[model samples]
Target: MRISLSTLGCPDWDLDTICTTAADNGFDGVDFRGYREEIDVTQHPQFTDRLVETMARLADAGLTVSGLSTSIRICFADKREENLAEARRYIPLAHELGVDTIRVFGVGDAEEHSLEELARVGGETVRDILALDGAADLRWLVETHDNWTSSADCRLLLDELPDDNTGILWDVGHTTRLGGESPAETLDAIGDRIEYVHVKDAVYAPDDENAKDDGWVFVLPGEGELPIDDALRELDDRGYDGWVVHEHEKRWQPYVADPEVAYPAFAEWYRTVLE
Candidate 1:
């Protein structure tokens, strides 16, 4: 399996530095977060041009643009239309960048939708996204997060959609947290539809308040308490060849330290554990 690092770890770093860091660390690709505040997606009249430039820069650095990671909420009660309209913008951009998949979020209660309503809304939103996807030559991926963080729930919703242009971003830590499902079972639920994986550790102190369901506090690949070995074994057993991006999401935490210092150590630890 190819391993990559999420650009989110270095949100304060420029794109060039992000790519250079990933390349220098012997990572195969860089999972670019184009929707971060640092990037001005609306500056260019032509989003495709921006995409080309972005991909070209990565190519120059000898790195592949693993995927376009975006923080998109698919289900909103009052703003659903506006959200979808803006989201359709990423499809063509992904296509132009020669990147096949774009990351998106599942429906959540933050949108004022009830749990049941969120599922219904989630299904409908996926249908709409897939409809728009037919012309983009790109795939739409919903991460294991928010309301659909449960693997069973996500699997059910994904079953409702056409797999031709839709799949799952199997975020192990997120799903494990929200689903209350075992990692093996979660992997079995998603099965072949997992387009990518976000590798992070969920750890907690015994006395910490957030110590529930595998604990809390997202950490680097190995520092936390996640059963990452078992998860990777399951992925291997399933023949999953997609990118497994190290998602050091809480890199800003003083305990976690800078990604530059944490990531290489994390990667080395990951390699050692996997081996």
Candidate 2:
């Protein structure tokens, strides 16, 4: 399997720094969750007007564009047109960047709507996006996040779409920590639909008031309670050779180690444990 780091880890780094640092750290690719201060890469000049140069820079660094993670949430009831527009805007950008997958979210409050409602709406939204021109060459990945962290819940969304162009971005951290699923159980449910993976580790820290409502505190891989090793082994057993993206999430959670520290740590740990 190949390894990549998401720009979410290095939200302060420019394109040049991102490429060079990724190359120096032994990462095979860079997934663009954000660039510098801009979370939406589609609107960033380096990716819009200066795309060719950006591509050349990555190639020179012996790195590829793994994928683009967008803020588009398909399951939201109030943002149907906005969600579709975001997908339309990013799908072509993904194709232009020669990246195969665009990450989206199935985010909604379960109290507001049932899982069935979210899955149905999210599935139809992704299907509409896939039907757009030039979307055939791209894959839309719904991340295992928010209300869809459980593989069983994700399977509900996948069952509605039933298209090869749509798949899951298996976020091992969420599935194991939040959804209370074992690696084998998650793979058994949604293995066939997993086209990409996001890896992070964290521990339930009830003492830290800043911890998430569920008391989860982000930690470097192998230091936390997440069963990432088991998940990676399962992927290997299934003959899955897709991108395993280290999502440091420094952009959203600034308390975590900087990408400078976290990126190499992940590269080394990943190699030590999985390579």
Candidate 3:
């Protein structure tokens, strides 16, 4: 198993600082969500013109790339061109960075379409993206988020895609916190398709002013009500050897703990809990 840091945790950190902090915090890779305020990082200079230099710096920091998270929505018919374009942009960059997996999300009007129907269209969108030049070899993973948090529900999309290269990027936080599914239950449903994971902790803090819209507040891993230990044990028992990414959403919630505090703490927790 490997541990990595999501740049979403340190939204304001420059690429150089991201590398240094990840290396110092015992992370094996840094998952690039974006840099500074740029959500579409392919448009950012570090990934565009300075790619070679960027790769050298990441190598100097002794890091591997976990993956890239994209805001591509596969189920939205309105965003089909946008989805394919994002894939087109990312494929070459992914080839350069040696990243094999890219994260994506799915969306649909539930009132108008069944989950299976949404997944069908979403699968076609993914297939179209994969048909783009340099995309066949890369894996596109739909995250367990929003409407797709339930493993069974997510499997509708996973089942719709080609089995060889598509799968789920399981976000444990959402499955437990919002989807109301236990770690064991989630694994039982889609464990085989789980090639990547997002690890975070949260508690029902409905009364807290700082709580998220869902009445839950994010917390350091192993410190909240989430089943971090159970999740790890379940994965280990199943011979799962995927990246465990600490997805601290500092970009979305500016008030959260800084990556400097959260990253190392996750590393420490990962060590102690596993031991």
Candidate 4:
């Protein structure tokens, strides 16, 4: 039940400020966004060095690393090869940083590919990345995003991969938005394959015709209309202890002004509700 914040919410800030703010706010860890403007491919070659420094900085600030969110698509056709090659470059870096997982997104949309094809492509991509073994370090984590956000869909993809080192990184908000599935059902579908969890809240209006595209919006854990309490209760009942990354995605959803300001509020909410 350790709580963390993804730097995705604060893509405009530097790593130093991010670590400092996270530690100051009583957060346990920071999920670094590896492909933002402030944090991008230029440092890809020096990843080992950069990650070592990042680790030290967080340690000095009394913070841990929840994970790394690499903005690389693993399931897309045109970008899959280049993305895998790029991911191969970060495996050693992640290991050196003592990061256990790297977050990746699946490709295709509900409109583009059949569920069967998406599952096959997602599984194949995961198998390939898991085989990299760069420095025999790091595990690949497929996130509940885009096409694979459904609990049943992700379960299908997970069935195709080796469950030992590869698994699901469940994003609650995204799952609810895209899949329109209940938290209990989603958890039941993924079962033990959930290696990580992205915690956020959203409001859904199923009655609206634009509901699928525009109903959801980011908010603090307990602030939004989402059933976070029920979700957390289910997670607790199941003995789930994965990282709860407070992923208020300000990059795409800018309702929250700044992560520096928002993370502390969310941390307080987590402490009050989850503690």
Report, for every candidate in turn, its global Cα lDDT versus the true structure: 0.71, 0.88, 0.89, 0.73
Q: Candidate 1 residues 1-275, lDDT tens each?
A: 88888766776666677777877777888876643454424334324446566677788888876887765676555557765776676666666666787787776674564556665666677667666754346777888886778877787668655678778998888766656777788877776788898887767665665454544765656677777777888888778888888877643443555778867876786578768
- The better-scoring model by TM-score among 1 and 4 is 4
Candidate 4 residues 1-31, lDDT tens each?
8888887788777767887888788888877
Please list all clashing residue pairs in model 4, or write none if there are none.
none
> Which stretches of model 4 miss by more than 4 angstroms?
39-51, 109-112, 135-137, 204-212
Worst 10 residues of 2 by lDDT: 123-132
lDDT of 2 by residue, 221-248 (tens): 8899899989988898899999999999
Worst 10 residues of 1 by lDDT: 38-47
Give the runs in model 2 whose Cα sits over 4 Å from its true position: none
Q: Give me the candidate number with maximum TM-score.
A: 3
Sort by lDDT, best first: what order? Answer: 3, 2, 4, 1
Ranking by TM-score: 3, 2, 4, 1
For each predicted model, how many residue pairs clash, with residues at least 3 apart or on different chains? 0, 0, 0, 0
Error of 2 at 76 (Å): 2.1
Per-residue lDDT, model 1, residue 217, is 65
TM-score, candidate number 2: 0.96
Q: Per-residue lDDT for 215 in model 3?
A: 90
Candidate 1 clashes between residue pairs 3 or more apart in a chain or in different chains: none
